[model samples]
Every structure is written in structure tokens, then in C-alpha cells.
Target: MASWSRLGRVGNLAATIIAVAGCGADDVPLTPEPGVAARKVTVIRGDQTYPMTAEVIDWETRPHPQVPERGMAVHITYRFRSTSSDSSAISEHVELQACAVDGRRVVLLCTSIFNGSSKDCWLGPSADPDLARTADVLILPDQMYAGPHAGDPKDHDGYVPPRNLGPGDQL
Candidate 1:
């Protein structure tokens, strides 16, 4: 009877361990709902302050004619309106700062603005769409680059690459 009880306890412990191990950090949901995914972050750069909202509008994983590997893409929409009305206070080149995927954070070294008013715009491919849904996205304002620097460095001209901004520099 004692040996049987010990075996049962060991089985229970094994089951408990399996259950705990199966639940990873990525299993925690970041967004409460599908559409209502948004986070507000305030950024202060130099003498300027930008009140911004970063929202995950859409996520997709599809084959791209350009990318044979069929990576994931995340679409993040941003709205920014400076508290100050001064033209100098206008937020320019607002872009993503970093994204956290399964606890691993990747600084967005490359990003783009899809479209928006002076107060609104969209930026994305946050990570690969495959990884974006499982990641926490963070956006911030930084100097925008002019050309294609994220892709092949040799394919573009005058592509002055921008350095990844640290957390201290971002929101």
C-alpha cells in the first residue's frame, strides 16, 4: 500500500510539472480583445513632447512574392498630436521603437509610415506577422530615414541607416 501511494504521488507530480511547463510566457494574452488592442505611450525628445497612441490594427501571415519564406506581418496604427500647437512641436517621423516577442525584445531597426494625417499614421511589419501576434509592440518617435536601409544595403543609394534607439531614448 505504501509503495502504491508513493507511485500515485509521483504520477501527480509528473502531471503537475507537465501542465506548468506547457504554459509559457507567450500563452498570456496581451490584448483583451481582437480589435481593441491599443497602448498609449508619451515620448519626450529634446525640448519636444509627443502624445502618441499605438494600436495593433491587423495581423497576417501570408506568402509574399518578394519574401519566399512567407513571414508574418503586423500592422500598427499610430496617432500623434503634440500638446503644443507650435509647428516646431509637430511630431515627425514617428516610428516603432521595439517589440517584445515571447519575452525577447527586438528593436525595430527598420520601419515605415503607410499613411496618415499630421495627427495619425500607420507603421508596421513590426516583426514577422508570425511573431507579431505573440509579441508586445512598443512605438516611439525618432528621426525618419529617407531611403531603403533595412533591406539590402547595396541595392539602395544614399541610404543613411538609422541606429536603434535605446529604451532611455524611447518612450
Candidate 2:
């Protein structure tokens, strides 16, 4: 009986360890609390790097023609700011950039572009621009993209573009 009890305890301990070890970073709750500012993320493209702030602003699990079952269509509002002297370091096509959520990367096509120019740019869905507020929706992941010059045939000063970096990969 004593040996049997000890074996049962060991089994329980092993089970607990396995359960804890199974949890990945994505398993952690990323939901942001209300009235809190979303974290800012940095993305690097080409010869420049820019800061991008994004929030889950809104989400809908409603079945759409484009989305299949068990999939959700999320609405995210984001802003991009250049860290370099040349404010235009960010491309106007930034809205089409790829974003990572819960370790899944998705491309958010620019539905609307606001305050677009050189220094500051904001992109989001066209339906509601004012809904964006600083409450926690989800943890923002660093956006990544291959710039326009990624595979240009013409070399600039013998400079070769680096390999395409996936979402969250830094320069």
C-alpha cells in the first residue's frame, strides 16, 4: 500500500509538470484592460525602422463570406511613426503590413488611411475611426514586411538587401 501511494503521488506530480510545460506564450491571456494604452511595437523595413502602435480596437467572430468557421475578423487601428530624420521612411502602403496576433500573423489590408504624410500615419478600417481608444484588447506584436527595395534588380552602391524577415523578426 505504501509503494502504491508513492507511485500515485509521482504520477500526479508528473501530470502537473506536463500541464505547466504545455503552456506556450500564446496561452497567456493577452487581453488588455479597459482604459489602458496599447503597447507600441517596432517594425523594420529596408534601410529604416519605424514604430507602430496598434490595438485590437474591435473584433467580430461573425461568420463572413471571406472567413471560415472558427475564424474571427478583427478590426485593428494602428499608427506608424518614423524614428529617422526623414519622416517619409514609412511607406504609404503600411496599412497592408503583416501583424502577429497570438503568434498568428495576418495581413491587415489598409481599409482607410488617416493623417497620411511623411512623419505620422494612421491606418484602420473605414467604418469607425473614432472607436480607437487606449484600452487593452490584446498584446501587440511587432509588424514586419519586405520593403519595396527588397528584391530590386538594380543594386544601390553594391548594397544587398537582407533576407526577408518574418513577423516580429528585427533587422
Candidate 3:
């Protein structure tokens, strides 16, 4: 039994040495691509102009959740000035860039305060100006507030999306 134990220890040490040597191979140097800057713009909903920062987050291609055979999930982050006058608002819109002819952008989360408000809407892409355009100035009415959502919709004021929106001249 003692001899068997000694042999097992020797075998384990040999395996470790082989593994270490195998991992000590020369590696090819990698050249990273240039970094892309985030597009900073403003969205005018109603009376207030909300500044926005848009970023595209790409992930490994995967099957779509809804349509397993032919779909994929694309993610994006949209940070803008919190709509709330009293507090700051920072929310994210994550959706799958479907392959459909007129794919719709979905809102995954509207995080405000601590709770998340559910919002489902189809948004056009920025590439297709006809479909989606950056909102440089957001406008809102005096009675209505455009801050992030509260526990209830009535908890906050209503808002109107900005028109003639585009990327800001200087970001």
C-alpha cells in the first residue's frame, strides 16, 4: 500500500510538470482595434431638453429567445439626464436587434429611484435616420415632469418626445 501511494504521488507530480511546460509556449501578439467614442446628444421631449449618451454593446451571436431558430439579442445603453427635477434619472434600454425588415427596439428596464418600471415600445435604429434619430433637445410641459417613472405614472407628470432631433454639435 505504501509503494502504491508513492507511485500515485509521482504520477501527479509528472502530470503537473507536463501541464506547466505545455502552457509555457510563445503567444502571438495582439493588436487591438481603435476605440469608438460614445455619441452624445440631447433629446427634447416636451419643454425640457434631456441630454443623452448612446452606446452600442455587442455580445456573442446567440439564438433569439423568442424565436430560437432565427433570432439574436443585441444590447445597448442609453444614459440621459434624469427626467426628475428633484432627483437624477439614469435608465437603460436593452433590446434585441432582430433580423426582421422593420425590427423594433425594446425597453428592458426603466430604473428610477429603486424600483423598475416596465416599458415596452419599439424604437428605430439611429443608423436609419428615417426610423430613429438622436434627440438633441427634450421638451416637457410645466405641469408635466419628464423625470424617470415613480411608483405610479400619475406620481410623475406626462411628457412629449422632442422633434427635429439630431446629434449635438459639440459633445
Task: State each model's CA lDDT, in order.
Answer: 0.42, 0.37, 0.31
Best by TM-score: 1
In candidate 1, what are the lDDT values of residues 1-171, reduced to their tens digit? 999999999999999999898788664333221111124445433333445434434333333335545454444445554555564534455543433233344333224432134333223323333444434555444323433453454664432324454322222
Give the per-residue lDDT of model 3 (tens digit) for 105-140.
222211111112322222222232332222221111
Give lDDT tens digits, candidate 2, residues 1-171. Answer: 999999999999999999888879653434322121133444433344444443333443222344334333344444555655666645444532322223222222222222253322223322222212212223223232234564454642322323322323321
Rank by lDDT, descending?
Answer: 1, 2, 3
RMSD of each: 16.1, 14.1, 20.4
Q: Order candidates by TM-score, high to low.
A: 1, 2, 3
Question: Runs in model 3 with CA error above 4 Å?
Answer: 1-40, 51-54, 57-61, 65-67, 77-159, 162-171
Of 2 and 3, the candidate ranking higher by lDDT: 2
Error of 1 at 124 (Å): 7.7
- Among the numbered candidates, top lDDT falls to 1
